[model samples]
Target: MKYTFSILAVILSSTKILIAQTDSLPSNSIVLQPVEIKQYFNKQSILELTNSAHTLSSSTINSQSPTSLTSALNTVAGIRMEERSPGSYRLSMRGSLIRSPFGIRNTKVYIDEIPFTDAGGNTYLNLLDPQSLESIQILKGPDGSLFGANSGGVIRISPQGFDSANDEISLQVLGGSFGLFQQNLGINKKVNDRYQFAFNQSYLNSDGYRENAAFERKSFQTAHQFNYNPKGQLKLFAFYTDLGYQTPGGLTLAQYEENPKSARPAAGPNPSAVEQKAAIYNKTFFSGLGHDYQISSKLSHYIGVFGSYTDFENPFITNYEFRTEKNLGLRTFLSYQNNDLSLPFQFQFGMEGIKGWNKINNYDNNKGVMGNPQANDLLANQQMNLFSRTQLDITKNWVLEGSLGLNKNSIRYETLYPLESQSEGNIKFDNVWMPRLATSYQINNLMALRASISKGYSTPTLAEVRSSDNTINTDLLAEDGINYEIGYKLQGRNKNWLVDLAVYQFEMENGIVRRLNESGVEYYSNAGEMNQKGVELSYWSSWNINTKFLNSIQFNAAITYNHYRFGQYSNANNDFSNNKITSVPDWTMSNSLYLILAKQFQLNITHNHTSSIPLDDANTVFAPKYDLIQARLNWSNSIEKLRTKYTLFVGIDNLLNQKYSLGNDINAFGGRFFNAASLRNAYAGAIISL
Candidate 1:
């Protein structure tokens, strides 16, 4: 730790002291500018922001293959994105994956200001096409200040829509090893001053490395804005997605080394993954409407309404599960500012509510087909969050902010088949108030420091309450935690270098954890308590010495080191007090380099390293550390005669073809823990913009 910090300090000092580079200037060259962050209630420049946040711009997202977000997202510190298979994504923020088996949990995701997470507290991150993303803003730590009830963190996604000034169209097509094929089309137009629209369509298919691990997706999305008055605008966002993916069960260590690409085979009395045709099928349609109104110079009103319906099916080794889910939500807020107070202040208050209805059924899995009925159930889940914030400028260079949210969650479920003791009931949680106190001080234009203390509360999702064990467990407790964080941001000479540092400690209670039954079906239980602490650092540099040798250079490096321990934790079978957390690596690092050559050619290379992780609470088994390397090269130029621009690119992943598991099933019953990720693969693609 000491060595790392010393090296980082040396880099910072040298960058700030070094003489600014000089280069021949182009008359029409683009200049760098300050980027504003909108994740909070107010807009602030990146340098002065109080919270720890990272933004993945379109330029960064486009540097990798268009197949998935795995490569682009890993560049951010304190985040791990894993693809168990194509179209099946699991995200871990703060290195906590205790409750998630598949999909995203403990975190909140918003798409174009719409709540894509729904009322279930689960995020189907793979449903959206990667090509449709424009930017992603990640807010780290437990912050329930404005967004609502969450413990892990928050992710705000701005899709390819929302840009009103873009008047062009773009298309992309890519194919690669492992039977990968993808196509994307994007169009945006500003039709006069009162109307604008954007549309995106994508098709993706991949035959994954493992047997029976095939995936396909078709997605269409659109956004429109109407200006009814000079001070008001109404926006509409909608999307339809049809997705199918095969879920190859985990493989044992022996199987992984013998045949890395083979699916899970039968164990003792269980069937093989191929025999049961394990997979997931989902079809969904979602839409949202938002209105922004400026009532006067000092006040504004904003409201958003969203709804989604889903048809989901999952054929697992234990059962064939099917569900129909409907969700509706509304978010509205009012902002008022006043300079009359002793300190200039801004105040915002809002209310958010979401309700979801899920009709779930489980049938016997007979060679991928449904057989006798097992369990039938219906559940209605609702969540309400009322939030308020007050921001005061104590001085020209200092800010103080306080925010709070009151949340309440409830679930009602009924069992229609296989009557049980707890056939029907309502479980409600008392209203809890989560508050945040934050302050930031900008010492100068080049350096700033900030600190925050916040409370977090998260209710278990429907899936966790009624897990695949085919039983409803209302005894499950909600998870709550408190986080203390401090951060520093710096910009070096000529603003060519930037650094971000954050340190935090979180203490949580009643942490939800996953458990498995004899049949390999999953259930949920609450671990007593947990203690987590971590440090995250990010460095970025851009050299302006543009020349034919190296027209431009962009470099980014991120690192995370965390220590987690179980606090007063015990289970029915074992006492796991003071043990290490499961599936959390001790340290992770990612680095990327981008070089523009001769103005029209570019090369990008990235490397990622993750340390070994304990596979269970007992800390008896661990997954070894691994390193990954990926690179891409592209050339782009304009066809002035046709008013168009084009780019051709090729990339390869897992350059060393190292065998590793991207996602692991912690505490597997039969030690079937690892899922082999794809080996060395290559892809090529082209994009035309007009």
Candidate 2:
């Protein structure tokens, strides 16, 4: 630690000396004004902090009008998003995907400061359409001091918030192979310089590549912002979605080699997914409101409230499941800035709380229909967080930040059918305190260096506690860890190029892992200890060509190199100590090129490569490497007199036609583990505005 600080001090001193020497430029030399790149400056400001963060703007997201979030997020370094099917996704950041199968875990997610991850530590990222989002911010590594208990990281989403512009309506449509189709309608308006309103409705349907792998969705969303007073602002958001998607069970290597497009075969008395109509049906409604009040010049306050309800159903080869879930939450914060002091300083404190209740039932599946009830239970979960943070500028070129977080989590369960006296109970974990200390040293306006050390904590989710095995594991315990990171950033002269680099190491105890039984049911267990070390790098550069054929060209690349291994892992007397972690690739890279032509046309080409991945802790089986290529073309025109605009686009994905498995099942009892990705496909779409 002392060595790190010594290096920082040296860099600071050298930069100061250089600044003194270059205080004035020669009169004969001409200064090249910095080019103004109308991008996410907010993201750059955030990056100046001691944490590693990235932002994906609307332009990057709409580059090809992606149908899923996986496409937009895949370009981010150290983050991996996989889609097992059209509507089913799994996300992991700087960690292996062994703990999650279908949903988001070890990470906290928020939409416009509203918690999308419930009290149970689960995030339904697939619920929101891609078009509804304007930007996304990702904080890499554990950030428990500010975002609460999460081992992986935090993600914040901003939906097209409160646009105060001319009123307009738009429509879009697209279709492609395998019976894919999409249609959308949207409108935005601002009234009296005080109120803004926006609404969107969309429908999506597709017949997937494999049998019994269809998907359908209908969504409606609306937002309103009211600046009714000079000192206050209020914002409201609401959405409803009805979604259904089929589940194509995994296949073994032998089975995949024989017939890659076939679903899993029946075993013993259990029926196949196709025969039992295995699918997920979900309907959800969510609403939230936030208010900001400027109580005084030195102090300000903000409060937000949110609620959600879901009705969900699922049918599998062995049984059928139904659940009704409800959630409610509140967030409040107060901030104070001190202008009276010689140096600028700020202090902030906040509290957040959430509660979730669920009624779940499992029944026997009688050929795609529910038969007799097998298990019935009601579960309640709750969490509360209190945090305080302070920032101070010790000098003109150095800053310090510190924060503390206190968290409490608990759960209760009651059995309602075939009940026993011991089935009704409650489980509570001890409260924990997390702390962070970080520093940032500005070498110059275009370069900065940072370092930090922090503690992390993550508790078991409700599903992991009482899972498909129909057992409540009271012995489960929360995982705890510590992280250390150092990073550097540089912006090329003239602001035409940017580079970000970071290196980090993490160690955790009582790591959680997934397991499956002979009945094909899922459960969780603890792995002894784990260690991870990695490096991440991202680069961006652009060139402008004022010619008749080309206007500008942009290039981006992100790469990750990781080394993860278990310290002391033993499962059923099988020692896996010092072996590689499951489902983690050694290297992953993404590159893209964008071209603007004649100020009215655009072309984009993207490439992605992933190295082989270990399938299990034993590291015996491996999934091969794969590469993907995609391209898109778009043209836009506007009629000024009529106040109208139109755009047409065409795209092709998987242009290389590489056979691959996008979302691979980590471990299986019957050797069923591969989920085939889509083949080469093309899509064309058009949009109209007025």
Candidate 3:
């Protein structure tokens, strides 16, 4: 990793040569444009943001493999996205994966303005094709003041051009190593000045690098917007996904080093992944409708209604589980602004509510066959958040803001299986208020300083409350914490270079952590106290060179340092006070370079490094450090007579074939810890524009 940093330093040092060469360039040289970041409650320029946020454009996403967002997102500091296997993803923000072993928890996800995360705190982020999104905005650290009940931060995913009125069609096909195949289709049409439609469809399948790790997904999405009134629009959208993946299970250190591509075999008392046909299957459909209206020049209202249904099944080494889940929700908000006064002010108030119903059944897995039932349970969950934000522009360059949210969550569960296991029933958490105060001062057009203090909380997700162990954890508590942060941003003279730096500390109580059982099943328990301190820094620059064959270049580098430790924790056999927090790396860095030559060819390169990670609270074992490199190349041409444009692209992952695990099982029982990642993989694809 030190060597990689040195390479980056060399690249940075060469900037002077490039700058000197470009000083007398022709007039056609490219000039980077200022960026706008919309992650805030109110739209603002990236330099004006008061919190830590990163934006990834569609071009950046496409620079990676056409299948997943893992590589593109990894380039962002403070965010971690893991794929234990294809189509199976787990996400974390600022070391929040401590409680999430398989799915997305503690975080809040939004597709456009719709709440995509269910009331139970689970997000099916893998359901969407990465290319379908126009951009992804991530707000790091806890931001419950406006998003509500999230300790890991917020992810705002914006789909392609909902407001654009262009009639276009495109198709893409891709094939890669390890029996990979994919197809994507995109369509957009402007029926008239008042009506517009956009649609996306994608399919992907892969026989993964390891045995019993095959995966497949079919996704479809559509959006419609109608301008019934001059000042308002009616919008409708739907998303459907049929996704399935095989779980290869975990391996021991010896097995990982010897045969990394092998599946988990039979242990002393457990069946093998292959023998049990370990896999997961899910089919979900979600839809929503909304109306946005401007009642007056100073006030506006927006409302949306949404519903979803999911059919999920999982076959594991120990059991076969089936679940049926449904969600219904509503969201409404109003905004008012007064810019005529000497000091301009704006405010937005909104409320979101959702109800979730789940029915789960678990049966014995007798060698790929489901036997007698073990547990049958029914559960219902409800969550509501009333939030508001007000911002004042005291002097144009100085901004002050205050935000608050009132959150309520409750859950009820009933067990209907083996009558002997009559656990608890209803559980309700008291209403909590989260408030934040922030200010940002623009010292000049090229520099800015910001600070904020906020309160955040996360309730136990449904999976955490009733884990695969078939036992209800009635004593589980919500984790609550306060975060204090200060940040700085600077841009170079020509706006070609931009830098962002943030430092923060968070102290939390009753932190949730994952626990594994003898059969590899998982549960959750509350760790007493934790202190998390971290620094995040990023630099980006883009400029066009003067050479005839060389066109433009973009470079970005980011790093995060975490000093997370347990403040108070103890169990029956150990007291881990002052120990390193589990599943967090002390240092992580990412760098990306994009180059365009002759205006017809392009190349993108990305590199990422992760330091050693503590695997448990005791800090006795660790996952060694590792690095990854991905590169892509593209060539484009146009047909003058056919009015068409096409691109040919090829990319490779894990260029060095480094041996490491993209995801790991923490505190795993029986020394079953490693989940091997793919090595030396390559992909190629073609895109046609019509």
- lDDT against the true structure, each candidate: 0.85, 0.80, 0.85
Residue pair clashes in candidate 3: none
- 1 or 2, which is superior by TM-score? 1
Alpha-carbon runs more than 4 Å astray in model 1 = 1-19, 22-34, 339-342, 420-422
Q: What is the TM-score of each candidate against the true structure?
A: 0.96, 0.93, 0.96
| Candidates' RMSD to native | 2.2, 6.1, 2.3
State which candidate, 2 or 3, has the greater TM-score: 3
Error (Å) of candidate 2 at residue 529 is 1.1
How well is each residue in 351-424 modelled by candidate 2, as lDDT tens digits? 88999998888999887899998888888998888988887878777777888889888888988876663377
lDDT of 3 by residue, 1-690 (tens): 474477458556755534443342223322232367675555787677888888887778888888999998888888888888887788888755678778887789987778899978888888889978877888987888888789878998877647677688889999999999999999988889999888999999999999999989999999888998799998888989999999998898899999999999999888899999999999999988889998999999989999899999999988999999999999889999899999999999999999999999999998878998999999899999999999999998999999999999999999888788855479898799999999899999889999999987999999999898987788899999899999999876556777788999999888998887656678899998889999888777776674688777778888888899999798777899999898888888888888877868888889998898887768887889988999998999989899999999999999989999877888877777789999999999999998
By summed lDDT, which 10 consecutive residues of candidate 3 come out lowest? 24-33
lDDT, candidate 3, at 47? 72
Show where candidate 3 strays beyond 4 Å.
1-34, 422-424, 518-520
Indicate the residue-level lDDT of 86 in model 2.
80
By lDDT, the candidates rank as 3, 1, 2
Off by over 4 Å in 2: 1-47, 163-167
